[model samples]
Target: MSDSSTLPPARLRPEAELARDALSAPVLARAARLARWADAGTRVDAGGGLVEEQLPAAAEQLGLSGDDAAAHASEAWRIAVDTGLVEITDEETGTVAAGEDLALLTGGSPQDVLGVWLTALEAVLADASVPDLDDLVDAMAEGGEVDLSSLDWDPEAESDFLDGVLGNLYLLTVGEEGPGEAPVPLPALAASVIVPSDMGEPSNEVLEQVSDAMMRLDDQFRLLEPVGLVEYQPVDEALMADADEEPAAPVDEADVTRYGMVRLTPLGLYGLRARLLDAGFEAPAVGDLSDKGADALLDGTAPFPPAAAHAETELWLAGRSPLDAARELLAAARGTDPGAPLRRLRCQQALSLVGAEAEPALREVLDDAELGGLARVWLTEHGARDVPPPPQEMVFWLTIDTVAAQLAAEGNSEELRALVEGLARQHSGFFDTVWRVEHPATPEVLEAMGRLHPDKKVAKEARKAAFKARSQQGG
Candidate 1:
């Protein structure tokens, strides 16, 4: 045998190395076969036993004794579960049952089984601190074939070998660390790893085709579990004659053959994406509400520029009706000119027609700096009516500001007076700021401010402003 230790380092690309490592291991070869079988929709059934009878036969075929076969099978099963290739369930009787749809062993074609094993093996090898290709090949080739009938059944040895293999596989594929210490799995890894170069977006049609293919593969493999029944026969002829009675009702073949299917989960979606990416399609970025005019349209209080208004209206119509023509018009307007005021006005009018549903999207844009003072004021006036009460942190200031502004804007002098008095009784500083800086300081405004100014300094300032406004107005 060649001295693996003395061999020169093999110069190969990462993909080539992965391909080589995958082909070197029997366990991985078997796994790859299983994956292909699963992809093809093959069904694999396990007989009712910890070690199925057919499993031994398959082991014998692979040149392993019963113990070795059992060991390898157990290891494979454990690895598969750890890698999420198979799901396990607990029976009421405390037995752990493997799902029927798991395409491991059970007469799946060697190629299919090998493909799954390789896929798993490749994943493990990606992170494994393997010494070299020679080391990996040597480790895989260490065990020799055995005959089951000649070997003694040592459950512990089998279990130990399985544990060792799994440990090595884990270390190789992930790292030499416990679960929490390892890096979190990325959802996009599969896309980067498995998909080939030709497949495109995972359209519903493509998914359906893949699902159909898997279903057909399952039917072809016949890897489904079988139901066993006990037959009680009389030992003696006389007893048999005496016990003779109607045969038990015929077993329903359909009931015995039925098995549940495994549907795609989120992880499976990641895996599917990976497979598609491997197969060669670029995943598209899903567009969000911000991408549409919904963000600008939702704030009902804001005075939109004609372009923004048109965009909002188009978005609303898109949500409301089949306004394809209107949408086209909006899109055209946006692309038409840099400073088209009339276009923007037209857009706003269209959005105004859309109404309330646009509120949330509009509110989201209130913090946008680009919208300018006009938009902010429009949003304040139009959006405030529908704006949910300000959150707790802002409530105190918001209420004071709202009340003060309304008092200044109110047409009725008596109501204005009452509002000003209320402000003076409450937060006088806030009232002072509103009266002095925020209001227009007309005689009515000054009188309202004067009534609320509680501090001597604030009261004197209010009085001076009130007198000047009165003198100017000739009141």
Candidate 2:
């Protein structure tokens, strides 16, 4: 459902605090460590599942009972699998191994490790059961809550509502309300998220609905607790029952509002914070004109969105020498990927700022194949006398530039592949001709095209071409 309210402001945090919390949170990282330890000491069963005895170690590691041991191990394994920390090639028979990303995650900076974990969490709703969970959470995020009556309340919608409440639980944890910072009470969360104005006070049906909502809320938290994203306390006795047992007894002992609190762990807070940033929440942009030179400023602003970069560049280019600006710009442009047309255009804008003064630097690179095309274009536009026609290499680079610009602007991957194929078909020696062009990005472009190509055969040829190009550059 759509709503007009804006998302809550994301609190700006220091790099030190983010890294410290991520390192201290320790649950997912602990799970990763255990996965590695298990691979060495414990044997995998024939079915590729961990041996039963290993469950005790995993459970004890986390301070759970033997009854909770196996489930705990299974949940950790699922987390490991989902986050690419563990790879089981064949679920039924193949041996488990630590995944490629495992080392990068474990050994990398805490900031990066938390980022990887959050990325996995972001995709947690990909299962068929909760496909629209992210969308529901997004709706609720507006003003930090949506009206309960406004939502569809059928069986599927009830399920979504449950997930949405759990998402809100994370939001509430990070939000400061009186600063005690414990898990938010279930009823309090419900009251904030759900507005039931139409339902009269204290009807039997209303009470039952509220009771069920609490139970569902508790059950969802229990399920998530094993994944290390939350700490849910005052366990509702109803959830301790086996799946085969009679359905959980309705709330009887105390008020439904009295218990069942959930809160985000430190890592969970950071994860949600990252999501807020991804959803267009602004954070402080540092490394501006104060310390960085034109070269550093150009490099720093190069990767930003066009409008933001343009604004930043306009400020940065002020009070700088035009000739020096041109030199820095051309130097920066030389380092950009051939396949990144947008970067080249930004380079063009920076180049244009230099006017006639940049001609001296442009002359130096005019005969250089990789940079020559840009130089030629810039010089011709400035009314330089009788510049040579762009060579085969420049034409090839420009073609790649055009396709990249189209892809970045329109994002049609299918059309990108088709465009690449058409160019390849037009010249059987396309790869060979481009390989010797001496442009800094020639090899990079060929390799990137290989990855982007839909057809395996073409991709393989593109890769081979890239390898050849690199070797030519080396020779």
Candidate 3:
């Protein structure tokens, strides 16, 4: 994903809760156990990996009994050494000792423990990018060093592809229309990166690539699950028994999940969001604006989806008095910049949540040149009596401003088209009078109305009025 794109905010768990999860992750937990077990007698090769003689003992120490136990122990030891949970005391003697970060796991704050987990996560991710040992062995050159070209593995490309997949998964989880908290099917997730979005039908070659990608991801997710990044249901082993057959497309909901299903755990969400922010993405989370001023709240949430924006605004208003919050929103809402209309729209939405106590604040701004139309609308909506009707000029100005705000907020949407048509039908001479409004966006709004109105005569009138508006503004 481009770093400049703003992602919908992730709803993260508290650091304390996430830290508990990080500590309990199988990989990090085993790494910690192996770290504490290391002492002066623990031998290591020049690369700091535990020597072959030590693997069996290390596996037994962890109460592991399996053909893969030695491999698992070695992996954990690598994590411990990489994350500073174990340190080699002397390269010549091959002696070892518990490292400083081991203490942090038990004695440090929640953030500190999570910091260690992030380091281990990075190590595992790097491991996941390397070709499997069997592949390397089969591709070995005469001198025993692996030939990367023969193996058909591009280290950087593999890493980038995995990163892109995780990024897509993150977007799926946090997106407004996505399957929030539900496990995404494996074939669909694999297709997201491999398949072109606009493609009508996949050829045999593309379908084969997707099948290969699914198999690769099944292995990757299995490796990743121990680090607590995802909760995964592995692709059923029965499907793998016949290598010649293409995996069947899931016909029903019951059959789909057997292919594989995966979702990010809450801890995974926090980890991925941190990585995104580090890479310069504007990844916002709910409550980010709670303590900010009213101006920040309005402008920062200007591009958010409607539901997320409402949730953020409610958080911002939670601590302030209704009158004070309403007054602050009104002050921030007064500007002539291009973004001003949307800010005012957001201000109106915020005021609606402020209720009857903000009546005085709304009444206070009824005489404001920029805010008067908005204040009057708020008062009338809340059932206040004796609210003076807006002057004719004010009504025209408000119409232009409201249309400008909607244009900014929703673009040339069907709803905006309907509103444009409705306004032309309701007013006998709206185009003639609206052209004279002194609002900065008047010409632009009129031009939009000209395009949106379906009636030929009314559309022609809107274009002429737009021309008049531009001439009056001398632009």
Q: What tens-digit string does per-residue lDDT give for candidate 1 at 17-73?
A: 333443444554443333332322222334212235445543444456754676555
Query: For residues 124-159, what per-residue lDDT tens digits would candidate 2 score against the true structure?
Result: 432323324455675573677854444453546755
Order of candidate numbers by TM-score, starting with the best: 3, 2, 1
TM-score of each: 0.20, 0.43, 0.95
Tens-place lDDT per residue, model 3, 1-475, is: 6889999887788899999999999999999999989888899999999999999999998889899999999999999999999999999988999999999999999999999999999898888888788888889999878789999999999999899899999999988889989999998899899999999887778888888888889989999999999999999988888877757546588788999999999999999998899889999998999999999999988888788889999999998999999999999999888999889999999998988999999999888878999999999999999999999888888888889999998899999999999999898899889999999999999999999999888999999999999999999
Please give the distance, in angstroms, between residue 43's alpha carbon in candidate 2 and its true position after superposition.
6.1
- Runs of candidate 2 exceeding 4 Å displacement: 1-5, 12-16, 19-27, 40-48, 51-65, 89-92, 119-159, 167-183, 191-202, 225-228, 235-257, 273-475
Best by lDDT: 3
Question: Whole-model lDDT for model 2 versus the true structure?
Answer: 0.60
Model 1 C-alpha lDDT versus the unseen true structure: 0.36
- Model 3 weakest 10-residue run by lDDT: 243-252
Top model number, TM-score: 3
What is the C-alpha local distance difference test score of each model?
0.36, 0.60, 0.92
